[model samples]
Target: MRMNVKLSPEMERFIQGKVASGMYGSATEVIGDAIRRMQAEDERLQAWHVAVRVGEEELDRGEGLPYTPAALDEITEEAIRGMHGNAPACRDVLP
Candidate 1:
């Protein structure tokens, strides 16, 4: 498709250089790539928004279980069980 685009001189030169270096077939290809990146970023932002909404709803409904530990050893043991000696020592957490 033929489209008219007004670019700043610096942007035009950057696109021209990419085409000259064979990184992109033409200025349109570079613009298309930039548009694709913006779209992917938009999708990720949308997913994050949905996650935050779900978290907020859970908080509003008080849907959380409090953690109680009678011994520090239990906390350390639970944290270290799945770790292959590669994780930092767990700290005492209060809830």
Candidate 2:
């Protein structure tokens, strides 16, 4: 495939440099790699958006747990103690 496009001076130099360095065979390879990376990033962002939406829906239905600050502090302290072999794990303390 043949295509014509314009790029900033810096971007043109960057692509040319990659080819000159023998890492990329040609400008097409650099552009193809850049597009692939952009696509992967888009896919990751889409997955994150879907996860956030699902979490929001769950929150709307009150499907999450409620933990007080004091309770969380106690859990953290217990975890630290467990790490030091001074107490059982927090899961052991849970019902």
Candidate 3:
């Protein structure tokens, strides 16, 4: 689809720079890439919202754990171990 887009001087320069630097073939490619990234970010935010709702429901059902310092330490340790590929899978920590 061919559509005309009006850009500010700065944005025009930015798109021109991308094409001149060989990072993008044209302004359309640059715009398309940006839109794709925005879509991915939107999806990520939606997933987070769903997770938050689930957590809230669990808390309402008295299924949530206490938020103690020890719990924080344990979660931090688990995250670090995960980065090193030495921890149990994330699902194993639930419940």
Candidate 4:
């Protein structure tokens, strides 16, 4: 699709720079890459919103756990162990 886009002087120079630097073949490629990145970011934000909603619903159903220093430490340790390719010590810490 061929569409005309109006850009400010700074934006025009930026696009030109991308092409001159051999990073992009043309202005179209540069704009297309930018739009694709924006779309990916939007999808990530949407996923976060869904996660927040699920968490809120869980809290409403009284499935929330109390925040404690011990719990935080355990979680941190588990995360670190997982990063190190070790199996989690406790699968079910909450009862």
The estimated TM-scores of all candidates read: 0.63, 0.66, 0.86, 0.81
Residue pairs of candidate 4 with colliding backbone atoms: none
lDDT of 1 at 48: 75
lDDT of 1 by residue, 12-91 (tens): 99999999999999988999999999997787777778878988898899984455675566767876684767756543
Q: Which ten residues in a row have the lowest lDDT in candidate 2?
A: 86-95
lDDT of 4 by residue, 1-95 (tens): 78988999999999999999999999999999999999977877777788789999999999999889999999899778776885654522311
Is 1 or 3 the stronger prediction by lDDT?
3
What is the Cα-based lDDT of residue 32 in candidate 2? 98
Candidate 1 error regions (>4 Å)? 64-95
Give the per-residue lDDT of model 3 (tens digit) for 25-69. Answer: 999899999999999778777777888999999999999999999
**What local lDDT does model 3 show for residue 17?**
99
- The predictions' CA RMSDs to the true structure, in order, are 8.6, 8.7, 4.3, 6.2
Model 4, residue 56: C-alpha shift (Å)? 0.2
Clash count per candidate: 0, 0, 0, 0
Best by lDDT: 3
